[model samples]
Target: MKKSLELLEFLGEPVSRDMKETLAHGSRQFRMSVHMTRVPSINNVVLYSHWHEELELLFLAKGSALFHIGQEKVTVRSGEVVFIPPNLLHSASRLDQEEIVFYAVLVHFNFLSSLENDQIQQQYILPIFMQNRRYPKLITREMDEELHIYPLLEEIRDAYQQESLGYELLVKAKLLEILYRLQKCAIHADADLDIGESRNSNSLQAKKVLAYVQQNYGKRITLADMAQHVNLSPAYFCRFMKKQFDLSPMDFLNEYRIAEAISLMETTDKKMTEIAELTGFCNVNRFTETFKNFYGCTPAYYRKAIRNHAGDGQHAVRCDTDLKSY
Candidate 1:
């Protein structure tokens, strides 16, 4: 338990909440960074959630892993990949013993000052992330064939190892190439996914409730509030939530609250007491107990572990290593 807490402290700290810092491996001026990390065991990580301010591209280079994005969970094995957007709570866990190997790149959409044009940013990036409310967030590869991201991964690996002059420039170019390929892949996969699927009208009420909760999680949200949002009575909404989401309304509310708490914990430097109140918990004791129940550690310890594990560099923000497989 202590070991897991330590790992979570390092990897699960939210990136956006507190004193936002740019990841150091890449040019801070560019709005993204890339790195490779290794862990001795999965328990050395924490099962917490966080989001980024830039688009995230995670390609499984080896082994298998599970990703939790909102209420949706998906598995990605070697040769598989996933896309996560800025400011969505998410986390990953290694699936098996062979150390999980993957290449990840965080891209700040309007990163370059030269490329901050509104039209280009909206055209190239907004379309991918803005329309995410209707679907469970995060994009995963659905095809059986492996995405040839490994070659690009290899190039990045080489540049890191060789460290010849201009290596960073080379890495930046390679990263862009990977993002372009991923964007193309996302458009293709999305088109295919839509063909066989019809909208789930039965879940319309649940969807509305989810959107409302996400928007208002930091405030005191009650069952009455959510029920009214979906035009259902509180009594029926309780049953409906159970039938649809496998959780009671209160449980769902707690999940959202804790999820928000986890994100704030990682990204911001706010004290645990303040975070507890900010995330809608009326009291610190109640908040601490609930947080530990969901995340398997006390909030203070969790924060401490993160500070301890992350190294002395600016960009060395660690990845989640302590979580059980989702």
Candidate 2:
């Protein structure tokens, strides 16, 4: 029991702070993680747009959240689950109420694959990973199969937390059952799956724009340059970006920069001016104003709050200021 607790503690370390990548060492072994997450009302914009090479399932146990998956926006309330496919850009924001609690189970397709010559890997798993099949992104308690699958999710979570002898085997079995059910549903609804080609094209273009911003956030970036990079006029580019992310290009850029600034504040003891410049705010005063506007507190106050809570090992910010608009 002591050994199990120690292992759980080791696995709880925060490996990924940025939105661009998720680094889970345990997931590399079994390619799966079942974890609980809480988003305070003040710090509601829990994650920025990011993509990973793992299938993600989110169960909302309490409260609500708005999720942006590619160009589609979904409002997932309590007693709901959302599935995000691998390599899809997604972000989440809390609803305008109390804190939100959710369970996230991330599974990489490689976890289920055997040797290269294995029939299961070649026939069933590879096609799902290759996007040859489509699965419903959201499943609510009202759905017909929820009674069958929700219990499996709970069992998996319980088996994971208990970590008894053969716990891993039990969890894997539950996951396989969930995937089989999802695949069966997908096959039945194959004819109704219509992810238009235009949406796909827009997603690709948005990814290009995101890459540009990520690479050049520290430097001066202009709307004209961004539009030219994607072969669109500036006016049209603004429309395209707003449609894709619900934020104009500049709004998204500022949000990304602020997110980077917050990361620096949490990880480093650098001066606010230095952090501002590094994150592309250019002017210290402007950075403070923008930070306060988005976070509902000055950067100095945020840093101090974080320092005071350092011993507790909890996040300092509790409320999200600008996320409600999205």
Which structure among the candidates has the greatest lDDT?
A: 2
Which portions of model 1 miss their true places by more than 4 Å? 1-11, 15-27, 37-47, 70-72, 93-101, 112-147, 157-162, 183-326
lDDT per residue for candidate 1 within 1-326, as digits (tens), equals 11222233244443433212223324554455554444333232323344556666666766776776544577777776566666454556656656665666666655532345576455544654453223223334444234455567667656644567896688677866665655544542355455313323433454566667667777888889989888889999998777655579987778768767755776788888888888889888989998787667887876666556455432223353311111
TM-score against truth, every candidate: 0.50, 0.80
Q: Each candidate: RMSD to true structure?
A: 9.3, 6.2
The candidate that wins on TM-score is 2
lDDT of 1: 0.58
Instruction: Output the lDDT of residue 169, model 2.
Output: 93
- The true-versus-predicted C-alpha distance at residue 322 of model 2, in Å, is 29
